[model samples]
Target: MDISRRDFFKVAGSTVIGAAAYSIAGGFGSALAQAPVVGSTQITNGIQSVGSKAKVYFTKHIDAAHLIKLYDLINEGIYGKVAIKLHTGEKNGPNIIPRDMAKAFWQHVPNSSIVETNTLYKGDRYTTEGHKETLKVNGWTFCPVDIMDEYGNVMLPVRGGRHFKEMSLGKNIVNYDAMVVLTHFKGHAMGGYGGSMKNIAIGCADAKIGKKMVHGVPLDKELDEAWDVVYKQDMLMETMAESAKATIDYFGKHIVFLNVMRRMSVDCDCAGTSAAEPTIPDIGILASTDILAIDQASVDLVYASPHNKDLVERIESRHGLHQLAAMHDLKMGNDKYELISID
Candidate 1:
């Protein structure tokens, strides 16, 4: 059951309650880890407040004007060296957000550069060189693409949670004054769904250690030994919420999010060549200052879609709603957001 944010934190108290970890295949063991929570009007650090409904701007045009319009709605407060964080689709991956679609926005933001990190798994993006190669192949050269982890790694503290003390992130993340989370909304092999939360949590973390930590892979274990160990789904999802919360805390109010609902695939761009064909039609683009609000709105739209049977089944089978519920537990954003269409 979904609880109120005030009640959630109140119940959690100062005690860090560690719930029993269960295998993903055994079903979402306890809703305790992924329980839902309502938003509060009172202002809180690293969380949104606009009554109960967070203002999520949307546009169905998907053209340059609509893109810029949605961006302008919440583009304030971002200044200095800005990092436009996004996924440059994997080699042979066709579901990623196109560079051309974002060209106008890229040009509008001064001193902004595209940023990303190497992947945890071995593939085109496993190494900096290979990742850059795929970036060129995928036509993301409109701006300088910085492979964030190439510099090194750093730790950011995850506040008010039942996880590790700190989350490991790419060292280069601190180099920028602000960030724009550009996410390609889609299904995932794990985590049930991918949106702004996953973009910053896994996308901003360094390939090896940071990614492993979010996956619940032991620090001492190598990549090969870690995969099998990190398969406990809810724990990993909870860790992702913690990591995303840490990232939001690190950047504070200087970060904003935009999610392109095009190419509605049941697999993440990270899946690359093995991704399944998209059955759900495009749902347009959404932008928001609230990470949880935007992601929640997107998932709700999918649930309401008549053509989303395949995507819905994919999400349900993977128990993906747990990610949102976990984010709610962390007070990341409001699940009940008022979506404003600019069509």
Candidate 2:
């Protein structure tokens, strides 16, 4: 039988509470204290904390069964007109998060709408009309889909950035009182990996100025030239970190993050038709209040996995891990985190 979203949550709520209690009672907290450290870094309960790591929750189940429960765990302090930010995937893209899973999550969130920005590259999501058409094709009709950049852009202050003074984002982003960053964890042709940071910086930014700012290119610059201009890999990573930090600052404590580690592809959802298949197996879903911790934890899990050679190579070749250090420098959140398994 197909489980309804409400039904999924009922069981998931119980399972999450039970599992969390069991894990806590099993000396998981003590293990974190006793866990050996390598220079103030410790890996305990599936966590690798920087200086006392943030808490990241994980579950092996990939479906709504796990996501709904994981959602409950990290959803604290999130209220008021919520914006569930995520990639609706491109038309014909098979690796994006399943709509059914999103449907389940929507049931648990009140007054929330799925929000996204148009793409920079020419594709189905390059323009508002085209993007809306693609949303239907991608099966995202279960909830309200807001194309943030459709109306116009807004200037978000980038307080401490090397390349940009301000970021251009969808003006309507300010409409939401809280944000839920729902990211599909995967590889990218450029960044090597796309998770919370990429999703916020690239995914949240307006297509024109915001994306160009991160790419270190001019708004009128051609796509071909844009890549060449930002060839300094660390610049791209740092700029992405800066843009992400700006978005984070805008929301303050009114944001939470979730990364679905299914469809472990070597390409981001933005690649659309060109995205490669999963060379690594589906890890699971993770949620955390800290952006850096969640992103760092995701990378740690991938590296710890036995089947991470391909993804690892992709990340290293593109110097994607540098984003973590850049984010650390930004003091976005702790790279160290305790990975609490709610399974």
Candidate 3:
């Protein structure tokens, strides 16, 4: 069912369940326990104590150097085998982050691999073979690109979630010691805005089981028929948040976020060549250790732009802002943040 803008905002603002106190089972749980605690109000480097607001770093320059600069600012906890979680994009999709920029940034990060999963929808990335070809066509051959779900899937506990008790993800995700969520901030057909949360939520899920969980499609449903089924928009957003929380809890303080807001389209990168042309002018890149803070900053920047009418309409029409509210009620991160200019 669809929700009106007024009713959606009221629901978003209302109190919901707090973060769950669940832990991963087996050895993964041990690693999670050692990971740095987040969601606290304490100030740290790259984060300020401006009324307990998280710090979100911004820069007008959208190049490799600037991207690396932003990454270094928040890279303190990122160590060991780093997984650069990013939307490698559909084949020949326009408005994706430039390959040159991503290549340069990838080279700068030591011991890192670009990580992705098969798409739920049937497309160029639906199969492992097809996904590899798409990666090549998209110019992602500069480094190791791991399709995390080529083999199988794994389940991660969804702490304090009303929708999902556990979320499914790529089993290979356990290999990474830290994750750098590199997102192309743009519009999504379903999630409103494809920010850091969407990048990890759907991007990390395996094609078969994990995706069905997020999309609320039955396992027996045919892939082509998945879109025909109707699901509540807010419930989808909350499920996305829950899936994101599973990933966040898995990595703990070992994860960081970066959102490249250059092509502000109302369509997701998954839309490929069929996606609508981006109307909003290019904005800067944003980085934060807090998942909620970086995405919230990106949305704020979009709304503040005078050319944001089209994008805003796309977001509002889809009730996309619920993403931020769901994340807030889940205590993933602070909605209030200090936007620090690094340029």
Candidate 4:
């Protein structure tokens, strides 16, 4: 039987309550605390302290070599059929993480595969076959690239979420015991900035059903009209946070995050070759076991740079900071983080 989104939620209701209660019992916070902080430095630049801070490692050098070095710092819990979740980008997308860098990083991780999901909008990667071809065109051929939703979808409980009780993800997601979220930090059309959260929230969901839920499109509505629907920006951001929480909850302590701040445009890689040219100089690569901390640190770095005007404008205009706030409210990770530089 093809289960509808509403039906999936209905069937998973009891499990959702149990998961939410577990989250309330400090599961998320406790899991976050398991990652030991390597070192700390004095906080600066008016970035306020809130509770205990997570550690975000930064290196100004952006290259394949540094990526592998960064990954080793926080690779403790990532194991067993690891999924390297990253945006492979659209066909010939200029601003994506360089394929050489990705290939090198993939080689560093034992038993890993590059993972992605089909796009909600029509494009070269809108279908499984097309997505495969696009992957080759983008030079992602050196490793196994899993299109997670190629078969079907599965519902995962969303803990501590106001917008969702459960989220639909690619069914094959369960095959992985751990995840490494490698993101290309950049401007996004709707969520302000696309970070680790945006990468998994939109990237992990099943193309048709899960994406419609995240975008607040009624399941009965035509999928082709997704862009035409009117939805609150904050609501969309909150839903994204909720979706990300589901993935984090499912993986528990077995996930890590890294964001590459090179070639950042005021547009997402989904814009393909048409993305606005980046004016902000390349920042660095940031890695952490903390998703919120990594993204928060990335945003802080951008704000600290003098060339941040355009990207900042794009993020603020779309209410993108709300994504971080929502994740904080969900107890996904600490917004306050100690930035440790390895330059």
Clashing pairs in 4: none
User: What TM-score would you give candidate 4 relative to the actual structure?
Assistant: 0.89
Off by over 4 Å in 3: 1-50, 228-230
- The local distance difference test score of model 3 is 0.81
List lDDT for all candidates, in order: 0.75, 0.77, 0.81, 0.84
**Rank list by TM-score:** 4, 3, 2, 1
lDDT of 2 by residue, 1-343 (tens): 1236224423332111112111111110100111121232244544443456677888888998789887777666678789999988889898999889999898889999999998878888988999999999989998999898787666665655555555677767777777899999999988989999999998888776677767766656756666667647887898898788767777777788999999878988877878888889889999888888899989988998878898999999999999999887777887767777777
lDDT of 4: 0.84
Highest lDDT against the true fold, candidate: 4
Winner on TM-score between 2 and 3 is: 3
C-alpha TM-scores of all predictions: 0.84, 0.85, 0.86, 0.89
Best by TM-score: 4
Between the candidate structures 2 and 3, which one is better when assessed by lDDT? Answer: 3
Candidate 4, which segments miss by more than 4 Å at Cα? 1-34, 44-50, 228-230
Q: Which stretch of 10 consecutive residues in model 2 shows the poorest summed lDDT?
A: 24-33
Tens-digit lDDT track of model 3 for 23-90 = 22221111122122234343233445556677788899889899999888888888888999999999
Clashing pairs in 1: none
Residue pairs of candidate 2 with colliding backbone atoms: 47-339, 48-337, 49-336, 49-337, 50-336, 53-336
